[model samples]
Target: MAEVILFYFLMAFILIAALIAVETTDLLSAVICVGAIGFGCALFFLFLRAPDIAITQIVVEVLALVILIRVTISRNATFVTGDREFFASVVSVVILMMIFLMAVQVLNSLPAFGDAVFAEVTDSASKTYISQGMEKTGAANIVSAVILDFRAYDTLGEATVLFTSVIGAAVILRKRPRKLPEEPQI
Candidate 1:
């Protein structure tokens, strides 16, 4: 009962933060609101007993907030969008809301928390993974084994892309070397 109340509260907080983030004209405020949304989501994950997800969310949110703060500090501009941008934003929000509603409806139809679910087929992908994951990947934790071994190439590619972007950003932000005045011709 308490968990349900907390969940609803967090959901409301996330929705409010998202709305504020989208509607705000100030870039910094919007970024802060986004961070709030991220924090709320992290809390929600924590409430759901997913400490790993919560930690990941918090780390990602902090990094994103830092990057956004740096960008906003480097430039001074109000985030005033024209009609087209506003229209596009509104359309995207509407689509997102529709998706959220559909997901909620589907979740409502599914089994409740702590409820037993009986399936006709006992042999599923999850069962196969649980039985063979450690053997195949040589990792005790199935999740880690799957991500670090089975999807290693994909993870490496993503890491490489992130590293490249970070390097590019560093190069762009570096102070330019001032040109020395040419010595007077002898």
Candidate 2:
């Protein structure tokens, strides 16, 4: 009961933060609101017994915050949009909501949480991972084994992309020294 309540509270908090992030004109405040959403998502992952995902979420959130700060340091503080832009945003949001509804309908047709979709398959992928992952990879934690061993290349690629983005942001924001004009000697 308490867990359910906590989950709902976190969900509400996430929704509120997201709405604030979307509506706020101040870029820094919006970024901070986005951080709140990230923190809530990490908490949700922790509550779901996915500490690995939670840790990743926290790290990614911090990195994103740093990048956002760097990117916004030289820019104007507030966002300004025209009426046409606002109209386009409204249309985009309506389309997104329709897509979200469709996704929810599709997901509702699938198996419920913790319920196996394939009962006939004696060893589900998760079951196999739990049973074989540790023995194969010599890692005690299943999540670590899966990430470090099974999906190492994918993780490496993600890290590379994140690194590239950080470097790109730094390059874009770097200030070049102005060339001083030389005066003619008498």
Q: How many residue pairs collide in each prediction?
A: 0, 0
lDDT digits (tens) for residues 31-84 of candidate 1: 999999999999999998777789999999999999889878758575656446
Q: List residue ranges in candidate 1 displaced over 4 A.
A: 79-122, 131-140, 167-186
In the range 36-110, model 2's lDDT, one tens digit per residue, is 999999999999899989998999899889978776667864564533578897998899999999999999998
Instruction: Give me the runs in candidate 2 sitting further than 4 Å from their true place.
Output: 82-90, 114-122, 170-186
What local lDDT score does residue 96 receive in model 2, on the 0 to 100 scale? Answer: 97
Compared with the true structure, all predictions reach lDDT values of: 0.85, 0.87
Evaluate model 2: give its lDDT: 0.87
Residue 53's lDDT in candidate 2: 92
- What value does the lDDT take at residue 18 in candidate 2? 99
**Inter-residue clash pairs, candidate 1:** none
Model 2 residue 140 lDDT?
Answer: 95
For candidate 1, give the lDDT of residue 22.
Answer: 80
Highest-scoring model, lDDT: 2
